[model samples]
Target: MLDSNKDIVLDELNKVFDTIDNSQVDQMVEMICGAKKVFFVGVGRVLLMLQAWEKRLNHLGIDAYYVGEINEPAITFDDILIVGSGSGESIFPLSIIKLAKKYGAQTIHIGSNSESSMKPYEDLFVRIPCQTKLYLKDEIHSDQIMSSLFEQSLLLLGDMVAMKIVQKKDIKDLHLLWKKHANLE
Candidate 1:
């Protein structure tokens, strides 16, 4: 039964990958690789995905931080902020994006809505048309619990982009990435 459930979930995720536009992925990679610094934010479980992205970006030698962390630097004109909000209306990420933009940081938004309110603040919007809990009524067809597909696909998306960044920088030595890991651990 668990295997059956897993298959159903994977099938749903296939739809999400199919729906993502390649152009948006390219835009996201270009923005990250070009930024002076990169910051990330999201709310709830989605936030976990973004936080993981922060670590991976750092591993790849990019200056990246999870916003609101104690040591995170302030946004600047040369920085970029990448946020994932399934609803595109999550108030927290939206508010942070506004501040980051006010300081001249380029903002990239990842959500399931192209017409989302957060769109106006974003320099790049990567819409992955998956159903989220915020729109459960509109997504009665989804079998999994709220927004699982989006979160799963988000992790995959982030890792794929990070891999590209590694290749672009010609980072062939895995030990180099490992050298950047926090020693406190």
Candidate 2:
């Protein structure tokens, strides 16, 4: 029974990948590789995905941050704001994206629903087809992890982009930071 469920999930994911527009992926990579600063955000489980992206971007020498109340600064025209939303209709994150665009920043939206109205406002959209529990009033359940398999796929996508950034920039020392930061006994 578990295997059956797993197969179902894989099949759904395959469909999602099959339909994805490869050009959109190129747009995302191009934007990230060229952006001076990148800010990533998501409301709930999607936030976890964005957080991972932030770490990877930092490693690649890009300024990236997760949105919060710490007056984290705004994204500029040369900046890219990466947002992760399963539904793409989530209000808070959507609003943030809008504001970022208003400030002249390019936006990249990652979501499970490609048809979301939010896509119209973004410069790049990477859709991961999966049903997300739309909590009442556009809220997200903190307990629900937004389809583990799909989220994992998004993480892999982010990593791929990060690696691309490293290659495009021809980073001089990939492991130098690790060596300096490593806690040696």
Candidate 3:
């Protein structure tokens, strides 16, 4: 790609960000804050991103768990499950969503399509505005390939929600997060 085209690509990304559902973002933050225990599930890079969010939530002193990790525990009525799947059709995550629902957990699904099967499973749906492999040739599109746009937006979305939580709780010290950091080197 030429240097001159970089601005155009960025502008396109900005367009997607500009129209993101602010209400959904607010609801996500509230769900995280209100959940007694928060568990996350996704695949590939999306999973990696959720792991990053798990660490941040721990930094904020929230009980955050990554699904499929050895330390993950059973979900219950007081808990919440957060899932990110750009395609919204991955069997592993959908299965986990079902199990979480059976356990009476509040589920939040973040993906591109509001019509995704995951929709019915979640209590709240966060529809990210970007292209996924499942709908690349459709009207909506992304300059970046595959699910990059959705993944990127998901990362930022998580970060923004974490920041809001930190602010709401008045968590001001960097040392506090450091204390929660793993001690075994």
Each candidate's TM vs. the true structure? 0.93, 0.77, 0.90
Best by lDDT: 1
Model 2, position 62, has a per-residue lDDT of: 72
What is candidate 3's lDDT per residue for 21-134, written digit by digit as tens? Answer: 888888888888998999999999999889989998988889999898998888999999999997779999999999999999999998877777798898998877678877
Model 1 Cα lDDT, one tens digit per residue, 1-185: 99999999988888778778898898889899999999999988898988889989988888998888999988899999998987888889989989988999999999887677788899999977788756744332358887888888889899989987887778788787888899997
Number of clashing residue pairs in every model? 0, 0, 0
lDDT of 2 by residue, 1-185 (tens): 88877776666556656766678887787888788888987876668877888877776667788888375776789898888887788888989898898999998888766667687778887866555654334222222244665576677678777776677787778876464332676
Each prediction's whole-model lDDT (CA) = 0.86, 0.74, 0.85
lDDT of 1 at 121: 95
lDDT of 2 at 185: 61
By lDDT rank, best first, the candidates go: 1, 3, 2
By TM-score rank, best first, the candidates go 1, 3, 2
Clashing pairs for model 3 are: none
> What's the true lDDT of residue 129 in model 1?
72
Q: Is candidate 2 or candidate 3 better by lDDT?
A: 3
Model 1 ranges with Cα > 4 A deviation: 134-141
